[model samples]
Target: MKTYNLAFKYRIYPNETQANIINVTFGCTRLVYNRFLAQRKELYETDKKSVTYNTQAKELPLLKLELPFLKEVDSIALQQSLKNLETAYKNFFQKRTAFPKFKSKRSTRKSYNTVSTSNNIRVEGNFLKLPKLGLVKIKLHRAIPQNYVIKSATISQEPNGAYYVSLLTEFQRDIKEVPSDNNIVGLDFAMSELFVSSDNQRADYPRFFRKLEAKLVKAQRELSRKVKFSQNWYKVKLKVAKIHNLIKNSRKDFLHKLSHELVTKYNAIILEDLNMKAMSGVLNFGKSVSDNGWGMFTTMLQYKSMLLGKQVIKIDKWFPSSKTCSSCGNIKDSLSLGERVYNCECGHTMDRDLNASINIREVGRSLLAY
Candidate 1:
């Protein structure tokens, strides 16, 4: 049995008092993280020294003595914030991400992470027990496995004032690999339809953001006309946030359902490993690329396939899947983006994405033979 971690998120309804406490915790965690990050930067610049999580964590007690309000919130959340800073620094040094930036007070999303200790975090019917805030009402939409053990919980408040808790749990399971060359399919990324499958099926993605763009623009126009920080302005801001949330939720739901369908139908799924960031920024296809949620779909396919003992294969990004003929394997000198239909001198003509998907599947099959 191998151990795995999974996160289950649930909507939480806290009393006014508990809500205040949660908000306070978020502020305290952010404050601690920013404080330590600034200190680390100053120390490294002045004395050529670095601060570790342990060094900063040991000072929390002294900080509480100086700022006393820090003692009112969960202590573990503060430590977790420091740990997050450490992680950020590690990622920066490893060239995996840019340097960490200071947390802004006006940020829309507010969150803090807390660990479970001594049964401090648990679910009881319709309530969840959390650190410092006890027995907040939770909407348990799905049942958790009996063997899963709660590890940590992340509490977050969305822009629309909805509170959610994502519980990280650990469990063990045995997964055996299922190898099959017959049940395989390839997918080519599509800007408008999401993807084209080897079997000539399109995802037929409904561009959620595009559909709601006009509504969002009108809402923002009204928000702009209102006085900033006024009651009316706040109300309009909430309306705008709700619209954005609707788009995000709709897109996520579609991707989840489509990924589930693909995983269920294929044993081995192949795709081209396209750099979505480059495609969005360098290629100037930001809006269309972001609306499709291709990156999220690929991630879902990978994890779901692994759990089901299936496969997800990605060919090289530089492969000339589009410029090469799928029938005769003739490589063309060049193929323009406007050419939606692929044509070769060998008398093969097909839709461009379908041809690319076929090439991806053949390449994946060859790789599997090795």
Candidate 2:
């Protein structure tokens, strides 16, 4: 049996009162996280020891007494904030991520997470019953698996005042396996296009930011002209945030659809292990590379392939896919970045990205054969 953890997110329409409560919960969670982070840092610096989660949790009641506003939100949400901080510290020590940083109220996104209890959390007709905030209208775009266990929910508020809840659940199930056959392709990342596959298929890159560049510039200029923190400034800020969120949403949607298609159609999918951070340092390509969202696309491909029991092979980053001739296997000593076509001494030639993709496919096949 295979065990899977999944999260399903849906848009929520909370009434004004409920929205206020959710915003307050966000503030309380942020306060709890920041306070504990400060405490841990100070204790470690001064005494060469750190405050653990339980020890700090014990101080929550005292702090709440001193700051009565904290009592207004769900207590469990505040505790979850501490748990998040603990996980962040663990990741840092394990070298998985950078050190945890302080969150800001000026941040465009805010969220609070809370686990489900037998009595406090459940799904009604069209509403989700959260701990403190009662039934809020939800758009059940898709139904959850009946056999899956409901674990926790995270309530998040976007800068445009839109709310969403993500449910994290777990279940045991068999993985869906695809037949191993010729339905395999190696993809090469391209700046002009999203990717070029060994089969000569092209996935076009959508320059989402470029599409909205004019609108963003106008909104930002309007925002800069306003007095900071004024009502008009807040309105302009929201406008800018709305455009940014639209670009993000569109990019994610395209990546999801494309990844799904690749996973469904191919049994073995191979790609080059690209060092995107190093590539971003190259002049004139940083903005285009960031806009392409290659990292997110690869992440989506990985998780989707794993979930469906498909094979995803990543070739070595240092492989000379571009320099070697795909047809004759002749390795050239040098290949310039401006070269659009690859030429070999053996009189074989091909498009640079296509030739790289073909080489990648052959490499993947050789690896799987062993």
Candidate 3:
């Protein structure tokens, strides 16, 4: 059986009173999770072989009853975090790793997670009543699968003072066979262009930050002119936050969609697993910003493949993807990043990136573990 996590974010219309309550709820959940984590640790250290999720969950009903302020927007979520802590301990005991820490309250944004009892977050008309919070008006856009059980629903605040909910769901399914188009592809992620597939397809990288750089600078300037914690400072900070979030959202969306397109259209994708951080270290900081999107691209490709039923074969970082000959398998000693054309003395010539991509694809076909 396979599990798929589907998350959707919808903007919410919340008045000041609702916003205040939401903030408090966020604080309350964080505090509860942290307090429980501390107690769990003490119990385990003081000679108890184990503390299960059941113990942590038993506290929630009483906490809710005592506080009465914590709206059950998500009861399952509170316990699920505790369960996750148990899983962390199991991993630590078996694998000898670091223990999990408490959740932080104020960093960027925090979420209150809830389990969907009906596998659906029913919105009666335009208003939806969450567990502890009364009616919250949200502009519902799309409908999700009701058969799939909702594991968690996370409520977060956008930079523009807008609230949104992300629903995480899972369904049991049989193993799926991905459709093969008899298409083998190689990917060369580079600085100038985003990527060149083994099939010689080039995608343009949309540099979002470059487009909004001026606006961000202006927002920062406005923020600097205002006193910290003042109304104006908060307003300016929100503007800056909005720009940053937009850039992040845009980049993630682009990568996710591109990965979906490649996995759906082709089979047997091969890519060079370069050390992006190490590569960036050699270049000056500013020079790396416009081009370092390979990490995001590769992550999307790998995780998305699990759902799409495809394989992403990663060639070693040291592999000479550009200098190596696809025809004769002769490895060249050195290749310059600026050189766009790859010419081998063996009389093989191709676009530098395309040549690299072919080498990666051929490697995947011949030596992949399969």
lDDT of 1 by residue, 1-370 (tens): 8998889999999999999999999889999999999999999999999889998999989999999999999999999999999999999999999999999878999999999999899999999999999999999998889999999999999999999999999989897888755899999999999999999999999999999999999999999999999999999999999999999999999998999999999999999999998989987999999999999999999999988888899999999999989999999999989999999999999999999999999898877632
Residue runs of model 3 more than 4 Å from their true location after superposition: 1-3, 15-18, 37-77, 81-105, 118-120, 123-129, 173-176, 179-181, 282-292, 302-308, 367-370
Q: Each model's TM-score?
A: 0.97, 0.95, 0.80
- Per-residue CA lDDT of model 2 for 1-370, tens digit only, reads 8888888899999998999999888888999999999989988999999778899899999999999999989999999999999999999999999999999987888999999887476678898889888898999988988887778999998888799999998899888676557878999999868899999999987789888989999999999999999999999999999999999899999989999999888888889999888888965678788888999999989888888888888989999999999988999999999999998999998999999999999888766531
* Cα deviation of 119, candidate 1, in Å: 2.2
Let me know the TM-score candidate 3 reaches against the reference structure. Answer: 0.80
Worst 10 residues of 3 by lDDT: 284-293
Q: lDDT (CA) for every model shown?
A: 0.94, 0.90, 0.74
- For model 2, the run of ten residues with the poorest summed lDDT: 361-370
Which predicted model would earn the best lDDT? Answer: 1
lDDT of 1 at 299: 96
lDDT of 3 at 212: 81
Candidate 1, run of 10 with poorest lDDT: 361-370
Clashing pairs in 1: none
Q: How far is candidate 2 from the true structure (C-alpha RMSD, Å)?
A: 1.7
